[model samples]
Target: MAWKKDDLFLFLFIFIIVSLYPCHGNFSQANNKQPNFRNASSFSTMPNSPYDYIVVGGGTAGCPLAATLSKNFRVLLLERGGSPYGNNNISRLENFHQTLAYSTPTSPVQRFLSTDGVFNHRARVLGGNTCINAGFYSRAEPSFVRNAGWDEVLVNESYQWVEDKIVFLKPAAPWQSAVKDGLLEVGVTPFNGYTYQHINGTKFGGSIFDNNGFRHTAADLLAAGNPPNLQVFIHAPVQKIVFDTRGTKPKAIGVIFNDENGNQHEAFIKTDEKSEVILTAGAIGTPQLLLLSGVGPKEDLQKLNITVILNNEHVGKDMADNPSNNILIITPEPQNQTLLQVVGITTKGFYVETSSGFGINNDSIVTVKNGNMSELKEIFRGGTILEKIIGPLSKGNLSLVNTNVTSNPTVTFNYFAEPEDLRRCVAGVSLLLEIAKTRPVKELMGNLSYTDEMLLNMSLNANINLIPKSGNETKSLPEFCKKSVTTLWHYHGGCIVGKVVDRDYKVIGVGNLRVGDSSWFDVSPGTNPQATVMMFGRMMGVKMIRERLSAG
Candidate 1:
């Protein structure tokens, strides 16, 4: 056949029209607005092909881990919630509590109140707590890396990698400036400037939020990933890990996940010999899922009739939570909005931190009692200091329920179970009171007494007692703490490295299975922990790369 000039023109015209058709109806959305991501809404649409790595829970550690692995491997990152972008309640600092307290099924955070009555929230969305928490970012103390038996140089590199992606310098707001001065006056001296190290005394740390009020969360790490080789699915909750026990030791071959409408689908490792199933679900979620997958204390699983794959006693043990008290001091002046910046770290293992903008919308506050001081109206409309006892000697565990996605693990947070913890709390309260009485604080603040109605609004505690203020003696602060202290949402020691997983984060008893995230910490890192968690994820990414290249 001979081609003519007019025929060529006609073919070119038709090709241009189709290119501008303005529809990207296929999974390979090269021209769609959000081309690289997929909203996993139906079971039939899931990719039947296997991947080199299947990451569960697209959270703080999971996002970075998946992103880093995608550089050389085909990856599938599964998240339970929608993207962090275009969510006002998540992107803004003022809406922190609103996102936490919301009960919507699609909410990025699921709020939980423990058996001990400590209110907390777990991450349900991408970037995990970095998307919803206090936003105070600090690297783990060097002592922590040494204690965890990690190479310090490699740990430092991981910190740099994370900080380069999501962390930002937060300027001290006006209220935070006052807090810094107050900390200085109370002997928390030698400010460490705006750095991310967990140094002693008063210091300002990094934040996920930038100076322009935009959150650069762990989700941003995906930008550095190989888009063609990576597939991210949101609104797809993982149900279980399918096993192939034909081998001498059982091996994880694939996973079962549910779409948004509750239809189930399965995804498995690819033909690569190095393929793996990694779990970066947080402390509670990782252990709970393992228990559901027939791994945990054999007695507990047997009681629930769950088949036992491995009787790992350390799976859900040694759970610890940081307990804190919210000390509200009604101020004479309207306070400026402030995020977590200025921190007063004590040598006695407590943190005295301050925050403003207590005047969050009424919807964020769970209860609104107009009779007392109008909880519907903001009551803590003044300066507030959070006295957190970070070093709790008590321990707890996560118990299993029936095997259903809707069933939440029973979390037992036995806070203040040790007398030493109570004593440390008492010392923390005394230090906070001392700071409150300082000339700088007293200059603008009023009497530091809690009315009965005011005390009722703080939090739910099992035991509470308070002695009336006397002219001669300090009021019973420890008794007040037993009634009002709540979890700081810092939990650790669920699946420790030595017992549950190897130093490389590989499950010792299972082939091609690994666990990361906050659960792998042997002990409480005594910090916000998001940075530590992220750094460890980066380390895993680096290790996988090194090992693969070395094997070749």
Candidate 2:
């Protein structure tokens, strides 16, 4: 078997040339140019061709699900918004927060807006709301995850698996440290060693993870590996879900959507095969899509002149959101000093008090570390019952006011509806005020007065006045509470787990349909939701792959 040096060189050269050959004819040409589609809207034009899996909504969940499923199955991802990969406005972290206001008109980040006109938050871009999110990546509380009805083993395994993939970065800069220390002085505690945790607690410190290093998004995550079987269609709005009822089990055959040019087209599922159709279109879009396709409450559909396929009353009920109110205190003399500046300038802020409470019986309330007592007192006297209680208790529903899928759905969150909800909020605010007066924090507050004088000015002027209060104030606490109410933008729980989708995320009454987004959360995590959403998306993806493989 011994060969000469020339013979070995010739063999290697021939092997390299053969390996470079394309599997199909003209593969090299196709790789160099775009597909033969007439336009960007042509993806929906092909109604006869079927796909192995049709995922609606290429958002946080849809994008990840499509990317993962494409490893073994052909996936068709439909996105209502344009791509965010190279979009300048969405690519940068600083620009992301600014785009929140315009997400609904053009992006995929739009959720339900509050009726009081205080909070208008959502994203409508290709990356979903993550495009304009605060970008805090922390895991959910263990108790909260268990509440979703999933097994403990499954929940922990899912959390670890997702965290490894996303890999959130801790705050390493000094400015972040300053903010964290300031928050600590005011009684905000870190929860679960992560940013987003607890259903109703104040989070002082949060970790800043570069969402894909400025491109942190589902689109980027999925597009990076570039699997051959995956195809993503942007700016394609799913108009309807066509169902095949001939078989014993109802099957979603395909979807019909509209393109940027107002042209309609249908994308049929591949024939003779049962392809699972997942609806990761998010809380509002998914329900709206279902209702439009005649798969919602029977009476509601009849009113709209659409035939009902499934009468699921829980489709849009139980809407929940974290309504936040800020309690800004004037530091004695701008604690933004050298040490604080160094903390903020050098490293990401440190997270204090990761886990404080222990559950009594797994479901019962557990007493945890009480954050800064002085700050709690300030919040109590300054904030109102409406801000504390009713804001937390009120639940809203999403309904289709119009048939247009692109049109914004009517999202009404009856914030501050219940008296008890208001009462709880008042208690929480009272606690915050107490924390502000503590020695460690009070020492930092020099000459600045906490009174109703500054509140009156900010409420009247409609501007964020961070200035310290004057030493004089005769107005009562009740007076300031009435005029200085604000709202938080952390919305959650519209399509809750068990209430909307089953434990497996499969729609209760529908076949071949699933939801994996913030809407699936049983309750709001009382903190930033970016991390929680990513975890849920990851869990759903893993479960989906396992289920498909088992069936095959």
Candidate 3:
């Protein structure tokens, strides 16, 4: 169905009702008064003994940092959102995606903004966006890692350590074969055992260990071990960073946060007499928090009447993001297949190099195939080879509008800003057209009426508008292409590495403050970033420990 603005709103409203109405029943069944395990009070509240290290944002990196750091130090983790321990929204994987989309506009889960003044999405809850994301995992490409100025030995060690800690796996069942066939036909290839592969013009592998299910997230990782030394404080928004200026070099001593009940409390990091602070609060939160604490651009701080501690102009400037657009192909039949049932193809020609020297330097392309008939006939049947020849590619980006800390900043992603991106997407769509011509898929296609108008409408908002349109043209391919554009939910690059933070993940010019999250990515990984974020988190953890030990 062509999703008109009204249709989109209706779908969203129904989704919201379905997701929220059921929560009341679940909440009634569970005791609400029981102290939430994710809150600061659930753990030791002895403010008398300050923690050895304090980590902010108990989501992707924060959770692991707390778990790993607690092995040697008393770690305090502060989270602004409530825990998803027994939340139904997080239990089932499919429900996770649905709930996430519904919560994007209103919930304080993740931050979202539109460059065209249209849409915005962001997660403000614990586990950050991970609690409600499509759980695709991938590590950074070796070349990408090398560019970060780290030694080969360190990168290898970090990858190996992270892989083990996260238990990375690959998809092996028939579903993988089916999806692979579909993608091969389209020309999009999978990454060759690298996280930072060129995606502009290549066919590569999609990141997946098993095509049957989603990977684990931060909550799953932390809950599995339940380490004793770590304390998680959820629903406590950090108001400001308390810095101790007594010494020549100012150090972040503690944090002040407001709980859900409107009560404020202060927690100090023992810092072993000189402890360090790690901010894994994600791209949006990390920058916002820093600005709120007067650590951003001097001019902007002055305008807000806030005192500037660090005059770093680049604190929130070099904002970048992978442009993501979604292309939905209507299958002739309703195949009882989930997203996991699909195969991923990573083509080599998709990624190209930009003037920038960053690895996977230019735009990234991802093509998802929809073959309902083939899937219905054989649960694992890879679509006919022709299907791969024509598939659609969606593109988007991460951008910042205003630098206000209180308001959720705009995050407009220019989904298909580059002509090359659209060319690749058009090719993918052509491939899908071929697949529809096949015998099995043809039967389904015959029953379905697909008009050029519908296709244009669907593709337009998907952000694939490279085709030119003439005022007099009807529903020509070029005209249809000219009318389409879209946005992606994957938010990244507000505080990229090398440009924003130093090689060790430390915010430059700031003493003892570091960031370890998706925001630290110098460029958006051409693929899903769950694994990459976790790996970087582990790497940051190692760096933090080493720095603290050396200082002590």
Q: Among these predicted structures, which one has the highest lDDT?
A: 1
For all candidates, what are the clash counts?
0, 60, 82
| TM-score-best of 1 and 2 | 1
The true-versus-predicted C-alpha distance at residue 291 of model 1, in Å, is: 0.6
Off by over 4 Å in 1: 1-35, 42-47, 271-273, 359-378, 446-475
Candidate 1: C-alpha RMSD to true structure equals 13.7
RMSD of each: 13.7, 17.0, 9.6
Cα miss at 279, model 2 (Å)? 1.4
In order, the Cα lDDT scores of the candidates are: 0.70, 0.50, 0.49
lDDT (tens digit, per residue) of candidate 3 on 270-364 = 65445667888886778777777777778777886777777766665545444322223343333232332232333522221100010111122
Residue-by-residue lDDT tens digits, candidate 1, 216-292: 66777776688877888888888888887777877888888888888778889974558999998888888888888
Clashing pairs in 1: none
Which structure among the candidates has the greatest TM-score?
1
Q: Which runs of model 3 end up more than 4 angstroms from their true locations?
A: 1-36, 41-44, 104-111, 118-120, 151-179, 186-215, 223-226, 245-250, 271-274, 340-406, 414-454, 461-483, 546-552
Give all TM-scores, in the order shown: 0.85, 0.71, 0.72
Better of 1 and 3 by lDDT: 1
